[model samples]
Target: MNINRLVWIIMHVAANIKNYKFSVIYLLLMLIVSCRRSTEIGAPVVNSSNAVLPAPTKQLSIVPVKIDTLVNHPVLERGVIGEWDSTDVLNPSVIKFKDKYFNYYSGFDGKLWRTGVAVSNDGISWQKFVGNPVLAPSISDWDTGYIAGNGTAIYFAQRIYYFYQGINDRGIANIGLAVSDDGFHFKKHPNPILATGPAGAWDSDSVGDPFVIEKGEALYLYYLGQDSVGVQRLGIAKSVDGLHWTRLSNNPVLDIGAGGSFDENGLGEPSIAYQPPYFYMFYTGRASDEIRNIGYAISTDGIHWKKISTTGLISNKLRSEWFSKVICDTTLIAVGGGKWAVWFGGGNLPVPAENLNGQIGMLILDLGQQRDMTSFDANSDWSRSLVKSTDVLLGSFEIEGDLGKRSTWLGPKAHLTLATTDHAGNSMAGKPIIVEGWAPAQFISSKTGQYEPLTISISINGKIAAKRTFVSDDMFRIEILWPEIAQLLDHTGFVEMDMSADRAIVPAQFGVSKDSRNLSFKVTRIYFH
Candidate 1:
């Protein structure tokens, strides 16, 4: 049929077909018919069904892909044996600007410690700036002794604000600030931004190790506070502009642990990571033996905090091969999908402070896939608003529309909570179940530069139940068998899934959609039989 005749027929049929489904089918048929006519006219024959369409200005197709484990070793090592930073290179503060990772770390040159800058495309490989010690001690100022130890950087208001520790010749340490447009160079603020507390106060001796988090309308700075009596603790300060600051009335937000606890000696290097309702703190806790390890804490308002554990979160037992002796100076970066890149300082020689062969290392902490689903798709049953009443509480998922088919885009870690009892209070202790879903097509890994096979894993109460390591990515009507659901669910009735590929991608980064959520594999429907 000719183009005009084909168009006339489609319009007439679409108007008469009252049912929208039939109208859609008729339009598809018309597309095929027109393509055939083009081929008959000696034009290029293209398969409309399989033809690639330009990405919408907004909204991207969710894809199924996984990333290889990032480099866990020390990405930024100490300099050559006799170089300026030969002794140790630790206490890293990193910020991403202009598509590059700028790591500001303390480099110990045996006699002096200075702050240096290193650049990296990926957080894994780093190249030290030829002009090292971007921010050194001002020989004639209060920071005449050295400028080093736990520091942090943040890009705020189109500028990089660097908070660092500087000690003077009198052995007094205080927090200083430096502004940088480019990550490589910096302009120091004349005087110290934060100094010691009043005499006899908790932080009278010195104050340093400044870690800042942009909370709400202001900037909350958490730091290490030392008293004249040689006791150390953690405190919080508030600021609107990055320059000025004020300490909270209730100083020392997190004090030393109980008499024989892990942090009895002191606390330093506080790092904050916010995941919705809770703010997580990872700090260096010191013991009586002068041993230092990473401790975990949680807070609602940035000023108040509660320690998560009695022992250190990462102590000698949980230490990595290279950082076995000491671990301090936490620099946390969230790489999406509930995962945090904890870049820290570690050393071999056991010491409470600096110069222990200190090197920078990183560990990825997957806090699980739970995200606060308040405003986003509130109508979805899987949302936080309605999930309390459901039998299976999904960590994260989305519905097609107001009332359409539901799909769960499983992130690196997925969590499901089963209701042990029904609304009528009837026990549902033991029950077999089956989950049906659909997987997505495989894709190449941008991080590892390799193609990864899909893997689906089920864990019961933190223990691995089953794992399809190399399953076909095209697996449809996927059935996950749970023979004894009761045995799987913990006392609190919690279970976890590692079904999707690790590392969810942000659609906005690829210019696909304005959606900033880190989305992963597609599970069209998850049915519990």
Candidate 2:
């Protein structure tokens, strides 16, 4: 029975037995104490006076959340129309000018890959340029046989400079440059700008998949280089005028990972972004399984790198039917709000002639909230803070890392409660406010325990508004919708959303071992429409 009903019965008996009032009163007190203890058996106790309290409920927690890896569906597919790109389309490089977005991509016409242009207003639906094959192969030069695609474009000095990989009759790949006044039509340079390295060098085999970015006055070119051993790695080349170039001393800036690691076999297909004090490099890591996925690393300077993870960020599992085994040739452009749009090439293996085509795919990454909350360094401000009624102890968490960063372990009996203010900066009393977040069960002891559902409670002001439960296969991500909370709003003042999750616990030798569950959610990004 519930505590309320049980208390009522105890009180009724005590009133009728007035002669034994002292005995009845004593028994009632014991029962109430036992109930309270049972309810809080595995829960952590908080000492309000000793604990450092969280910020006021009106102050929204700025904790970062992971980006939805599956947000980008195939915006552009190949062979939807049987024209110049009748077979396959791949390697997309995008630039936004004014209101329109331009995509320079490589397409195969059953013979050789050639460069093409497509334009879009919303960056989703695309219309191909009528004059397709803006950059094609030359019959008598180094790029004689095929203009093998992977093109990187930058609008600089009032002109668009296009860099691509060109293959000769001997099947050797070299970096070539092309110039265009408008984004559609382009003229190729007479000779290869960067050829293969000398014998016994790391990049002696071939260098392709050029990614160019203007850092200050100089332009840095990052590309994939293969050695005589057939292992692919990444290398950097610098240029002043975006034409003449010099390779960095540490030729292969990033090599293959350790044996049995995700990038153990090779690392290639570099895409780089320079944001503030850090330069992020996202590349394709090939494993022994021959499956290719996207991985990332960060560098203070463009030459030396610290890998974010040994595994790939965008793996083969994220690939669609057209993208059976590989997802490489990444190109990233920042979309506002701490998010980036990544475009890459994806294709299947055991190549069937009818389905041998590769297509361009897109995925998004949010760098802002990618850090783990379980562990921290001396500089962390979150250590030893009280989250609602739960106590958080610093230096007491298990260490783990994901996406190239260390993950903080939420202890058993720990809970994260965060408040959010509406992004519209108005009352959401009548209108529905959508809520989404990831709440996966962490650190399960048994196989079945992994499927256990977690509870989510949403409160407004100081009163409970809505509650729900969800079980997710993706332990790293989940979403919840709350319409009931909307009905409770008054539509006058700012709405404060207080979100909390129960402590994640596992069985122990004596009783139960409990840990805090990381609760990261965002209210500003959710929209009703």
lDDT score, candidate 2? 0.55
TM-score, cand. 2: 0.57
Kindly list the per-residue Cα lDDT of model 2 for residues 164-210, writing each as its tens digit. Answer: 87766666667888888878878888777777777787766566778
Whole-model Cα lDDT of every candidate shown, in order: 0.59, 0.55
Model 1 CA deviation exceeding 4 Å by range: 1-72, 315-317, 369-529
> Which candidate tops lDDT?
1
Clashes of 1: 0
